[model samples]
Structure formats: structure tokens, C-alpha cells
Target chain A: DQQVKQNSPSLSVQEGRISILNCDYTNSMFDYFLWYKKYPAEGPTFLISISSIKDKNEDGRFTVFLNKSAKHLSLHIVPSQPGDSAVYFCAASAFIQGAQKLVFGQGTRLTINP
Target chain B: AAGVIQSPRHLIKEKRETATLKCYPIPRHDTVYWYQQGPGQDPQFLISFYEKMQSDKGSIPDRFSAQQFSDYHSELNMSSLELGDSALYFCASSLAAGRETQYFGPGTRLLVL
Candidate 1:
């Protein structure tokens, strides 16, 4: 069973607009969430993350919101630039001690119109 | 800054052959992870090493094994490879385990014919 899911395969947004990408998780044990951006022929790079204790976390133009009860999370990029276009993956961990592994969703490809 | 460095950007091998992929993590980082990405699938966890110790391992075949050096560098070795093993392998590093952010290397593309 897939614990994390990104239902949307792709999304398009005009440049300089707010781009919202959504992710959902089924495991109630997951308390930490992260977003990674990947380009073709390259590995994923860490984008932003949010802890369960906080409902929202923002860094520069990127913001991540987490809803514990709903088992959902969303990544918001304001003034989306062309460089922001890539495959975004949502991953979750149970926040346990020691070697807790991550569960990743399929991914959502974000496109920015010039 | 050297985020993460993986060797042999690409590998082409025959079935039943042996393949080894190497990774160097960020300086001062203590944990290394191996992940495999297949077509239309998200990168899946394979194994992780912390301080030369095996920390977390996923449900992968016994042919897949990994080792970590004293300096935190790691390698993934696959023996008796099969045609179905063709995919992209990624190496990542983190300060510790659990929910911390992980830095990634470019990745190695392996093709088993």
C-alpha cells in the first residue's frame, strides 16, 4: 500500500503566480513531511519541510503547510519562476528515533509558463 | 560545497555480472543512503548507513548489498545482476537518521542487459 500519494501527475502555472502542489498520506504515524525537486538526469534536491508540531513553515518564497488531522500537505511557491519547473516529490517519515526511513509519493511535475 | 558525489555516471552490464556504485557524502555528514528510481516510480529506499553501521534497509533482494567506510563514504554492490535491475541509483547523505533533510548526488544510471 502507498502511504504517500500525489494524485496530480502534472500542473501548469503562469510565471510570477502562486503555484500550489498537494500531497496526501495514509499512515497516521507520519509526523514529518518534506518536499524535493528533481530535474531530468539529476537527483532530487531538498526544498522545504514542516514538522508536525507546526501547521505551517515558510522560507523565502517557499511555504509548506501540514494538516495532521487530514493527513495532507501542500507546497506553495509564490512568484513561481521558470527555474521552479521540475518534478516535485513529497516524502514522509514517522518521526521515530534511530533509523526511520522515508516513504515517497510518485511525484508531480510542475511547469511554469514563460 | 560538495553536496554528494557518485561515481560512474552510467553503467552498462550483462546479466549475471557484478556492479558496484560508489558515493561520497557531504563533509561532516555521518549518514549515507541508497535509493533506486524506476520508470514512472518515485525513488525508493534501499539501504542506509550511519557511522559505518547499517541503520535501515528496505525489502530488496539479497543480491543488493552496501558497505560504509570509516570516513562515511559508502558503496552499493550488486552481484548476479538481472535484466530487471535496470534503473537509476541515487546516493544521499544526511546529518543523522529519521526526518532530517538529505543531500543528494547526481545519480548513476545502470543498465543490465
Candidate 2:
């Protein structure tokens, strides 16, 4: 069962434009969420995260919005750059599974075209 | 300081063979995790280790196992590998057991024939 899901397989955005990726989860028990970015032949890097208690968290050019009622979250990148082209994964963690174990989404491949 | 590091970036093994992957966490880190990423798929959690003990074992098979030592490094061992085991395995480290930001390694690509 895929507790976390990213319906979009891929998205293309022009450089300097905004890019938004969405993720949904079925498990309400998940209290922590994280986003990761990965490039070809490389491991995923920590991008951003938010707790269920917070609605939004922003860091530099990246912002994560969480809607607990909807069990959905989104990552927005402003003025997308070519370096932003990578696969984005949304992950959720529950206390039952321990904090270190994460359930990842299918992943959304984002491409920023100049 | 350098981020999490992994060794033997690539490995090829035949069926029924064993493959071992290693990971070194950042200094002072407390938790280490193992994940598998097959082609066209996201990373799947394998297991987690912390405080010199096993913390979590995800939906992985008995063939897959992990070990942690010295608070700095960990290992993932696969015994009697099958062709389906071909994939990229990743190692990640976090500050503590509770909710935290995890730094990841470059990943090891394993091919089982």
C-alpha cells in the first residue's frame, strides 16, 4: 500500500517561472512530512519539511504548504532554475514506524527549461 | 563537514551471491537508514539503526539486513541475491531518533544477474 502518493509523473516549467508539486497521504497518523530532491546517479537530498501542526514553512526560494484536513502538501519553488530539474519525493513518517523510517511517494520529475 | 558517505559505488553479483554495502554517517549523527531505489521508483526504506541497535525494519525481505557500529558507520548485507535485487541503494543519517533532517550518501548501484 502506498501511503504517500504523488500523482504527477512529470512537470515542465520555464526558467524564472514558478513550479508547484503536490503530494497526498492516506495515513492520518503521519505527523511528520519531508521533501527530497534527487538527480540522476545521486542520492536524494533533503529539501524541506513541515510538521502537521504547521500550515506552512518557507526557506529561501522553497516553500512547503501543508493542509492537514486535506491530507495534502505542496512544494513551491519560485523563479525555478535549471538546477531545479530533478525528481521530487514526498515522504511521511509515523511514530509507530520510528522517526528514521520513511514512506516515500512515487516521485515527481520536475524539469526547468530555459 | 562532509555529508553521509557510502562505499563501493557499484557492484555486480550473480544470483545466490552476496552483496555488501557500507555507509558512514556524519560525525555526531545518531541514526542511520538504508533504502532501495529501483528503476522508475522512489526510494523504499529498508531498515534503520541507532545507538548501536536496530530501530526499524521496513517492508523488506529476510534476505536484506543492516548493521551499525561505532556511532559513525553502518552496513547493509544482502544474502542469496536474486535478479530482482538490482537497484540503487541509499544510506542516510539523521541527528537523532526523533523527527530530524536526514543527510544522504551518493548511493550504491547493485546489479544482480
Candidate 3:
């Protein structure tokens, strides 16, 4: 069963516009959430993260919003740039056997057009 | 600025053959995690280790085994590989004492014929 889901397979946006990607999770035990951006044939790069206790976290042009009651979270990139075009994955972290385990979404491919 | 390292970025093997993948975590990191990603699918966690000991298990198969060395490197050994085993294998590392942020390797692309 897929505990984390990113329903949107792909998204297209104009350069300098805002882009938003959504993710949902079924496990309430997850205490930490993170977003990673991956380019073709490359490892995922860390973007931003939020804790279960907080509703929002921002870093530069990227922001993450969490709604615990809705079991949903979103990543917002303002003034999207060409370099921002990549696959975005949302992952949930849960502690099991005193170690952190991550569950990832299917990933959303974002394309920024100039 | 150093990140996780994985060896043999690509590999090809026949069914029933064995393959070994290696991962070297960043200096001073204490935790290692392995994941497998099939085509058009999300990454699935296979196993993890912390401080040279097995810490967690996931969807790993009986034919697969892994271990972390004292030097903080890990290896995944797959035996009797099947066609379905062809996928991208990723290794991630983090500090057990830090927040849950895992830095992933570039991934090893394995193709089992």
C-alpha cells in the first residue's frame, strides 16, 4: 500500500509564476515531512522540511505548508525559474525500532516554461 | 559539502546471477538506508543500519542481504536475481542524532536480463 501519494504526475507553469505541488499521507504517525528535487540521472536534493507540530516553514523562494488534520502538505515555489524544473518528491518520516524510515510519494514532474 | 557515495553507477547481469552494490556515507554519519525504485514507481525502502548494526527492515527479499562496516560503508548483496529486480538502487545517509534528513546517492542502475 502506498502510504504517501502525489496524485499529480506532472505540472507545467510559466517562468516567474508560482508553482504548487501537493501530497497526501495516510499514516498519522509520521512526525517529519520533507521535499526533495531531483534532476534526470541525479540524486534527490533537499529542499525544505517541516515538523508535525508546525503548520508552515519557509526558506527563500520555497515554502512548505502542512495541515495535520487534513493529512496533506504542499510545496510552493514562487517565481519559478527554469532551473526549478525537476521531479519533486514528498516524503514522510516515521521512527521505527529507534530509526527513521522514509516513505516517498510517486513524485510530481514540474516544468517551467519561459 | 561532501555527500553519500555509491559505486558502479550502472550494472548489467543475467537472471540468477549475483550482484553487489556498495555505499559510502559522508564522514562522521552514523546511519545508512537503502531504497529500490522500479520504473514509473515511487522509491521503496529496503533496509537500514545505524552505527554498524541493523536498525530497520522494509520490503527486502530473502535473497537480498546487507551489512554496515565499522568504517561506515554498507553493501547490498542480491542473489538469484530476477528480471523484476532490475531497478534503481539508492543509498541515503544521515546522522542519528540530527533531524530526519537523508541525503541520497546518485543511484545505481541495474539491468537484469
Candidate 4:
């Protein structure tokens, strides 16, 4: 029943500073929200996305914030670098039947220490 | 820039052996999704398809099965296999009219014994 929740499994930043990652959801009919960036074995890459009437969305250094009455969502990666570490997933987009489905979160292993 | 393609990346079977995972989308994409990550958990959607048919379904099981052809490529036929079905099998692609971005496929590390 983990309807998306990234309770911070791990996070350690420093490289250039600024690196936040958090996510929570319980299905509010999820409208769309994404952020992926895996590395180890690779597979997830697309990063940044938000829509549920939007709260914030940026693309240069990566940024995504959505509140939607606190269902929570966040992913900021300012100066941070070092390939920006890895493992950071927070996805939510539902539209059953007609397809479109993604609900993941249980990843947050960013570690960029220079 | 092309993405989403998976194959034998890795595999090993035994108990009740039977596995066949493949996916190749992203070239006119049409939608296809399948996920399963288990060691430490997180990714878990189990089925999806669009242009070829079978639209949605998750937590798949029942010996597992999937399809989506017509040159779109998709397959995931696991049978009997167990040992928690060793994990890590992802394949994602989107274009059901840009179904909100989805492109992944660098996984297929199954191991059952």
C-alpha cells in the first residue's frame, strides 16, 4: 500500500550544496509528478516534472515542488554535483484503464560529497 | 537519442524455471510499462501497454504474462519461477500522446535458484 513515499533512505550532500529530496502521496488521483535519476545499474533517468495544477517546476539545476494540500513532493538539486550522486525516485501519475501508471518512491540515496 | 530496450541483461533460473523478458519501445513509442524491483524494494507496477492493447494492471502474478507486439515489442512471461522471483526488471516507454514522460530500460537482472 505504499502509495509512493520516499521517507529518505539516505542522503548526504556537500559537493556544491543544496540537495533536497522528499516525496509523499496517498493517491489524490495523482495527476502527474516525476523525478527519476538512478545510476548504479542505470535505468531511471528522466528528471523533473510536475502537474496537478502546478506548484513549481524548473529545469536548469533541477527543481520540482508540488504541495497539493501537503500530499507533498519535492526535488531540488541546486549546486550539487559529482554527477549528482544517484538513486532518487519519486513518481506518481495515475490514469488507469486508458493506461499511464507509475507510482514509485522508496528511493533517495543521493550522496554527493566533494 | 533513443532509449528503452531490454533483453538478456542477465538471467539465471532453476526452480520451476521459465523466464522470458524483453522490451523494445521508443521509436514512435506507443506506451508500455512493466516494473519489478525487489531487493530493498520500490518499483512495482507490473503491467501496461497501449497501442497494441492490454492497457493497465499491476502487481501482476498468476505465473505472469504480458504481450504487446505489432513491432512495438514487449514480453514478460515468467512461469512457476519463485525464490521471490528474484527481481529487477523494468521497461518503460511512453507516447500515448506523451503520457507524461516515461523512458527506462536498463534492467533485467533475474536470478532464481
Candidate closest to the true structure, highest DockQ: 1
Each model's lDDT = 0.92, 0.91, 0.94, 0.88
TM-score of each: 0.97, 0.96, 0.97, 0.35
Off by over 4 Å in 3: none
Report the candidate with higher TM-score, 2 versus 4: 2
- Poorest 10 consecutive residues by lDDT, candidate 4 chain B: B92-101
* Cα lDDT tens digits for candidate 3, B1-113: 99999988999999999999999998888999999999887889999999999899999999999999999999999999999999999999998824569999999999999
Residues A37-105 of candidate 3 have per-residue lDDT tens digits of 998878788899999999999999999999999999999999899999999999999886587879999
- Residue-level error in angstroms, candidate 2, position A106: 0.6
Clash number for each model: 0, 0, 0, 0
Q: Highest TM-score among the candidates is held by which one?
A: 3
> What DockQ values do the models have?
0.82, 0.75, 0.67, 0.27
Backbone collision tally, model 1 = 0
Lowest-lDDT window of 10 residues in candidate 3 chain B? B94-103
Per-residue C-alpha lDDT of model 2 across residues B2-74, encoded as one tens digit per residue: 8999999999999999988999998899899898999999888888888878988876789888889875699
Give every collision pair in model 1.
none
Number of the predicted model whose lDDT against the real structure is largest? 3
Better of 2 and 3 by TM-score: 3
Q: Show where candidate 1 strays beyond 4 Å.
A: A95-97
Clashing pairs in 4: none
lDDT of 2 at A11: 99
List, residue by residue over B40-62, the lDDT tens digit for candidate 1: 89999899899999998885679
Minimal lDDT window, size 10, model 2 chain B: B63-72
